[model samples]
Target: MLIDPHLLAVFTVTTIVALVTPGPDMLFVLGCGVRGGARAGLLATVGVITGDALYIAAAAGGLAVLLTAFPVVFTALRIVGGAYLIYLGVQMIRNRKKGQTDDPAAGGMSGRRAFLNGMVSSMANPQTFTFMVAFLPQFIDPAAGPIWLQFLVLGAILIVLEFVADGTVGVLAGRIGGWLRARQAVRRRIDAATGSVFIALGIRLAAER
Candidate 1:
C-alpha cells in the first residue's frame, strides 16, 4: 500500500510477465488439467500459489541471504529440479504404449489429493525458491513502509494475479482435454503435447543460470 507509484507499476508489469510465462508450475497444471480435469487443474493452481506464498515470506524474512551465501546450493537445487522434471516427462512419454487410453467417464482428482500433489510439486522445485529470492526485492522501497509489510503486499498481488492467469489456463486446458479424450487421435497428440511441454521446461530450467 505504501509503495511508490512508478515502482508499483514496474513491479506489476514484471509480476504479470512472470505469472503469464509458462514455467514448470504452469505446465504441470496444464498436464493435470488434461489428465484429471478442470477441478484437478484448479486445485493444483491453489497449491502452486501456496508454495509461492511460502517462498515470498521466506525471501522477505532473510532466506535470500542464505541463497546468496551459497551459490552452489542454488545451482545444485536447480539441477535436481530440472532432472526431476525431465524424469516425469520421460515417464509420461514412455508410458504411452502402456494403454493410456482416456476414458470419457474418467474421474478427476479429489480435492485433498489434488491439493497435496500440487503443493508437493510446487515446493519441490528449487528453481521456485531461487526465483522468489531473486525477483521479489528489486522493487522494495525501504522508505515506503515496513519492509516485510511491503513484501506481503507485493506478494499478495503476485499470488492473486497468478491465480487468475494460471487458473484460467488450467480450466481451459482441462475442458479442451476433456473434449479430446473422446477422440483416439487427439488423445495421442495430447499425451505427447503434455510430455513435450514437461521435457522442454526441464531443459530450460537446466540451462538457466
Candidate 2:
C-alpha cells in the first residue's frame, strides 16, 4: 500500500472520523475489553481486521457484481445485518450492570473466542462490504496503478486506523473496567447510547440502495 500525500490525507481523515464514531464494532470491542481483558480485545481487533481485509479483497474483486446483480440479496443482507445490530444493542442494554465485582470468568474470554466474535460480527454486517464497494471506486485511479493494488492500499490504511483506535479503547477499557463497574448508572448510559448508535446506523444502512 503506497501512501501518497493525497491518499494519506484522505485516508487519515476518513480513518479519524471512523475511529471516533462509536458504533456496533466499537461497543463490542469495548464491552469485550471490559469483560475479558486487553489480550482478548486485541484478539478481537485482529479478527475484525481480518474481516476488513477480506472485504477489501472482495470489493477489489468482482464480488460487487454479485451485489449489483442481485439487489434483493443486498437488501436481504441489510435487513439481516440491521436486525443483528438491534439484537446486539438490546443485549448491551440488558447486560449493563453497576457496582459489580470483577469476575474472572467474565474476564477469561479466550483469544480464539474473541477473534471469532469479532470476525463474525464484522462479516454479518453487509453494510461494511457494500460501503467498501461504493466508496472505494471513487478514490481509485486506474491510470495511477492497478485497481486492486489501489484498493489494497486504501484498505490497509483503514485497517491500521481501526487497529489504533479500537486497540486504544480496549486498553483503556481494561484499565477502567473496575471503575466502570462501580458506576452502574454510567455503564447503563453508555450501553444505551451505544445501542442507539447501532440501531441508527442499521437504519441508515437499510435505507441505502
* Number of the top-ranking candidate, with lDDT as the measure: 1
Tell me the tens digit of each residue's lDDT in model 1 across 1-209. Answer: 58988988998998888778877788888887886578878998999889889878877788768877986776776677667767766766776545544556233345565566566567656667766776777888788788888888888998999899888988897898888766766666666777787677777767777
C-alpha local distance difference test of each model: 0.75, 0.69
- What's the residue-level lDDT of 147 in candidate 1? 88
Judge candidate 1 at residue 142 and give its lDDT.
88
- Lowest lDDT block of 10, candidate 1: 100-109
Query: Would you estimate the TM-scores of all the predictions?
Result: 0.81, 0.72
Best by TM-score: 1
Identify the runs in model 1 with alpha carbons over 4 angstroms from their true place.
97-102, 105-131
Give the poorly placed runs of model 2, Cα more than 4 Å off.
1-4, 74-103, 106-108, 178-209
